[model samples]
Target: MPTLVLDTLVNAPIAIVFDLARSIDLHMYSTKKTNERAIAGITSGLIELGQTVRWRAKHLGVYQTLTVRITKMEKPYFFEDKMIQGVFQSMDHQHLFEEQEDGAILMRDVFHFRAPLGPLGRFAEWSFLTVYMKRFLEERNRIIKAVAESGDYVCYC
Candidate 1:
């Protein structure tokens, strides 16, 4: 299992930032490039533990679908999602948010994933998947930061 972690200091309140993050609509906006968006289930309202959401997206020019279930939920702080069934062998992502003295937020993303194959998996990771995942997560963070800093709950641009 390889773990990839990416953290960002966002210029926004913890609650607002967290709310924006949990919003699927905003996620669609942020991932315009990846063609990622929530298609069904937990589309709106507060996301709680055990809630599951279906995701559809295009990665590497191919459409990919996955259902993720919330495993942990702590208001205005941290939440985690585990893939019920997806392309990868396994996936667990946790998002954490905290407030700064200036009222901004510190957002962190931690991901753990296992390649499908065994030793060949390690080779694939070393060859491409690792870098791909890193770029994917980094791009996501960039969009999140943009959405948070924009001060608009909705991404209009």
Candidate 2:
């Protein structure tokens, strides 16, 4: 398994950033370049703990579908989602938020995923998947930060 971690500072309230992170609508907006969509389960609105969401998207020039369940949550502080079914052997993404004294939020993402096919998968991770996934997460976080900072994230939730 390869893990990717990212930390970002957003000029927004912790609650706003947290909600935007879980908003299905904001996800779709962020992934517009990939044409990602929630096709099953919670198709819109904020995803709560224990809920499953099925997403279809085009990545690496291939159309893929992945299902994930929100396994843990702690209001505006933290949340974890795990893959139920997807291209990876296993996938887990944890989102954490901390409020700064300046009233902004420090957001962090910890993502872990294991590809299939044994050695080949490890090679892929080393050669490309790791970098690709990092960029993917960065892009998503960029959108989240932008939206949350703009104070319009409430409209998506």
lDDT of 1 by residue, 22-73 (tens): 7777667767887887777886555678888888999878999988999988
lDDT of 2 by residue, 97-139 (tens): 9988888799999999999999999999999999999999999
Worst 10 residues of 1 by lDDT: 148-157
Q: How many Å off is the CA of 153 in candidate 2?
A: 1.1
* Model 2 misplaced stretches (Cα beyond 4 Å): none
* RMSD to true structure for each model, in Å: 2.2, 0.8
lDDT of all the models against the reference?
Answer: 0.82, 0.94
Model 2 residue 139 lDDT score: 98
| TM-score, every prediction | 0.89, 0.98
User: After superposition on all CA atoms, how large is the RMSD of candidate 2?
Assistant: 0.8
Q: lDDT score of model 1?
A: 0.82
